[model samples]
Target chain A: MAGEVESIEKFLDEYMPSAELKEVKRLLYGKEIRLLEFPAEAEELAKEKDFELKGYGCDAARESSRLPKIVRIAGVQNKIVLPTSAPVAEQRDAIWAKISEIIRCAAICGVNILCLQEAWTMPFAFCTREKKPWAEFAESAERGPTTKFLQQLAQQYNMVIVSPILERDEDHGDILANTAVIISNTGDVMGKTCKNHIPRVGDFNESTYYMEGNTGHRVFQTQFGKIAVNICYGRHHPQNWMMYGVNGAEIVFNPSATVGALSEPLWPIEARNAAIANSYFVCGINRVGTETFPNEFTSGDGKPAHKDFGHFYGSSYVAAPDGSRTPGLSRTRDGIIIAEVDLNLCRQVKDHWGFRMTQRLDLYAEELADVNKPSWKPNIIN
Target chain B: MAGEVESIEKFLDEYMPSAELKEVKRLLYGKEIRLLEFPAEAEELAKEKDFELKGYGCDAARESSRLPKIVRIAGVQNKIVLPTSAPVAEQRDAIWAKISEIIRCAAICGVNILCLQEAWTMPFAFCTREKKPWAEFAESAERGPTTKFLQQLAQQYNMVIVSPILERDEDHGDILANTAVIISNTGDVMGKTCKNHIPRVGDFNESTYYMEGNTGHRVFQTQFGKIAVNICYGRHHPQNWMMYGVNGAEIVFNPSATVGALSEPLWPIEARNAAIANSYFVCGINRVGTETFPNEFTSGDGKPAHKDFGHFYGSSYVAAPDGSRTPGLSRTRDGIIIAEVDLNLCRQVKDHWGFRMTQRLDLYAEELADVNKPSWKPNIIN
Candidate 1:
């Protein structure tokens, strides 16, 4: 409205009182998980690296009895640096180079934990539905080169790093799975969780590559917070988000690689809704930019075949359990959003809202048992 | 940003392309169930009645074999015409008269199914916490004057009506429950569903009057569509919405009387999110204005005691399965939003989104069983 097209938040800010604006922000998101203003040195580095960086702080009302557990978390949304035709090693090395710099920037900004976009090490090639060269990109989750690369960065910066990658599970049968490996600040590789839900519509064609994640909703107990990852398409499933909260995650990162054409409308609402419904902080990190492939493809929508996956439209943002949210990052730029949130806010909002108290989990547990039954009938009163 | 503050939808419309604006509308609500344009006679009557009216239609893609089953549904939000000091019969008559006129208007507009706000016949008196006079409002769901009055109207117009009222169960120790009575088009007293999750937060204090709903997520299969009611505080629970969806509900009405200070932010998102997740139509109806009781009350918020319940901002609207929505009615006005929608869109969206197919019910069914256990531990990896 006043600034660049990306700055939609400024339009509301200019027209309304800060309180009312905060109300709307709170409706979509209330805990301001925005980009924190950097010191001059880091700003200079960001300028030099030609990447956008933003951050915010999610504060809790102070209590004399208990201290706040403020933890800094960062989400990086980015695009491929090199062409798909480039040698696989060079392409991965380019991403590694760019991410290493961003990780350094995160360290300077005091990010205690950071998560990269889904399959950050390679192109979003699931759309191709091809197996040969793309499957070659998959590597071991525990001892993969990507985890090895990030483990050093995690230890060096004393930061917890979540790396979503195409994992080659050699022990399981040389199968490939879309997975996120959590690297602790102590340079140890925590257990990994696979993408729970796979897309079958349009060009997502993820069913050809992997099935539903076998790992349950797993929360990694980190030095900063209890966190989990709802990878990519899993955001559409509210139950997936709910179980993670049930497992006592303080924060959940949605590392996704989705295009604007299929999911732009759902992008802003889903993660924010999950955060509000589950009473936890959520970081929605999406890959930016459209990548044109060497070959044409059809999305099965009866339209003409296309060469690209459409715009990823990166507008990564964060949501607090209180339903407060930060303004999203630039839709057209590679950027990272850093938010320092007090884990105490999670419990505080839960107490204030009483959502956990009122939510009748017993009701659903019984219903779901019947729901899974083959002879189940909906409770319809005709 | 454009005309009246009530028209927030206009701001986005004026600033962006129609398609992009449609995308935003699709996010919050896509099925544009809104008030249809009335005939000249109805318009004159609406003008004379001095009520705000708005409407829309939610369309579906054409299928060669199946015809579109467009059904109009209306939600009425209003203030109590007579103050609490007035005689109970006089107050009830005033509401009946006003609603009779609105129902007549709805009939003229060809509304197939209509739902009134929560506790529509009485002031939202749960804030007062005094039972002597307030409990007098509770009546039989089947034999109550409100049900009989609405039954005759429903039979006259051949339109189904949903009446949310405080129920007095004489057969069960005269207990009071928040219930919605479904009057079929044939004027038969269909089954009733009670408010599932009762509130204990702030001034709500609903638990003093009613326990959790005994009737589970019940869907009423009417001539129009299979629908359910998630009363007031139950909207705070995603599982409540999900269960109704599992019960094959095509539309879910959220009849609420929430105040601004406690729930204004959640008003817009919850029902809309339910629509998207559950692949159903959601009509979010809220009561308008503040009602001061004859006696003072404390909300237990550690604040000064007051006589009035805070304002019930009544920006009611409808959300479709595709995430499209109609613009809301005035926040501080007596109004009804009528929306014409095709129930087929629910299945269409489910087909497109693959949410039901990808949703791992078997997984949660197993997990929730453990979660319901007393000695269960979260899957937290240390």
Candidate 2:
């Protein structure tokens, strides 16, 4: 029996090559399986450019362009306990120190445009539905310490920084908004676009904190490329991605903080869809690790009280215009994923696919005009 | 040295289980890995219900609902040579016969809703750019021979059929449009939706044959469920999928005939995105095999002359609202993929995800209203 089993095992090994078996495991386990890694090239380029690259490939085809406008984009996913027991000021400082370290790492990696996870200044504590203390976390989008910290790094590295923050609009009677502040490479603040969509699922309770964004889809033309931030919940809205595309965004960054049980399956689908549907590049960033609050919270489902908001399985990835993607970052660790993207691919893909030329916007506008009307009805039988 | 290598190999094998190694290979190769298959359950149900079920697992969860609205949907991907040398009438007969054989197999599968590939009645000869002979493929949407043939099968099997056809609008000077004729289980005509987005890339030259569809995003109310058809190129449009969701479609069928090189990568992404974005089921179907035309066609890319329009690589699959999907059908051969879907999951997901309730359509409408005006800009710097 032992001999027979050994022979069967040998036959299996012969039938399925070890290399093929390893790839299958990567798919089944949904682990970080790198398709292309050019550590030697990155190391060489970093030394020449005086900027370190923690080692990632540059997917630029030489023959595809006469003058390629290539840019390295980095999305950082970090997780840390806010130390709610500490003073609010100390808590803020600790969070900033942690994120700045990550940003410093991104700078060493030679990222031209760096994006931090959504609302990086504070913990995702809105699930508690406690207002007074959480409201204290919101600050001025421009004058906030978070902005000041990112601005210093942006200017030092001469790189663009997209910092998603919970903004306290002081001029507008202290109304709060989820906003992404775009800082130019010159360390000057560009414009900011507030998150258009606010999630109301389970423990989100985002509507309690801020109303829908007043800012429409805004694209910022930075030194590296034309970019926009589709902050967190806005990723679910296809029209949000479309408007950015219509506005000529070459790359859109979706910085998010979602849990594993809530949206892990969808994390891989939407950004890639945006990249393909809009004929552009997408850098999807998510926060990592599990944060347990002081009090237990219910997910609104028929489940027992849970201490944490499920796992924030960070799988930050970059989706290219050609429907190719970088291997996602580790699900339970802090990391930055760097991808060298040629902005020209946006135009090439659009021309090759003709998605923009063929998209029927006029037809959609007419249909949308009826959405707010009382006489409007979807083709529903029930 | 050989003994040392063998010891190292044994250690590596022990470290990485053979089962995991096998899964990794499947991912790397992107093989047809079945995520769901339940032939025995389907066979048993078919015996009791007077219909046969081609063994495929259904995504419906029994405990999730008191009365689960579980419906088995089938998407048929077919490939048949048109025999252009023969009389066009004989060519039509041969194609219909081949498709009917596939449809009969679908009936055995106890599929509640069955969808055929896009423009399945004739060869995809639009590449030749010869309108004189290809226009002959167009027939009346309501009184078309394809609709008549499908009506017979739909009634006999008590299944709803979505048949995409090249329609000749007899009411308007015999104008042509890409349309999907919806046949009810009782053999009644359940209205039709036209293909809104038309591809004009390379040899597609679809604009030469038919104009863009004007039917709007119309969801057909069938006996089985509320469904809509996003014919071929229309799948590329996110708003096209959104409007259907706005109008309340539970399932959207994207019947496509695209070559492998042109869109094989996107084939898996878009429909799955639609399912996740809209919180609905997407049954994406595509035609298979390569058909060599009498004349060689250039794809306008300055490439060598090619007699075939690349391989279709049929990989029809169904994506559920929970972001899970069935393994796609064979890429090289014609086949049918069946999936059992619990329609109630759509509402469950919407409630959990809150994508619909949270989507700020009003904000988008305000932005889209500026699309035609000169004052509009998408935050572009250059």
- What's each prediction's TM-score? 0.96, 0.87
lDDT of 2 by residue, A140-200 (tens): 8888877888889899989999999889999899999999999999998897888888898
- Give model 2's clash tally: 18
Q: Which stretches of candidate 1 lie over 4 Å from their true place?
A: A1-7, A10-35, B1-7, B10-35
Candidate 2 local lDDT, B1-382, one digit each (tens): 2211211123334454566544322222222223334446544544443332333443444553368887888898877656565666777888787667666666766679999889888778888887767788889889988789889988998999988988999998999888999999998888888998899887788888888887887787777788999999888889989998888899999999997657766777788889888989899998887777777778888999887777786778888777777666666666777887779888888877888988777766767877866776555653
- Compared to the true structure, candidate 2 yields what TM-score? 0.87
TM-score of chain B of each: 0.94, 0.86
Per-residue lDDT tens digits for candidate 1, residues A263-378, read 76667778888888899999999999888877788888999988898878788988878777778887778898999888898888888888888878888898899998999998
Estimate candidate 2's alpha-carbon lDDT, on a 0 to 1 scale. 0.76
Top candidate by lDDT: 1
Question: What does the lDDT read for residue A297 in candidate 1?
Answer: 84
Error of 2 at A3 (Å): 35
Candidate 2 at residue B24, lDDT?
29
Candidate 1 has a DockQ of 0.55
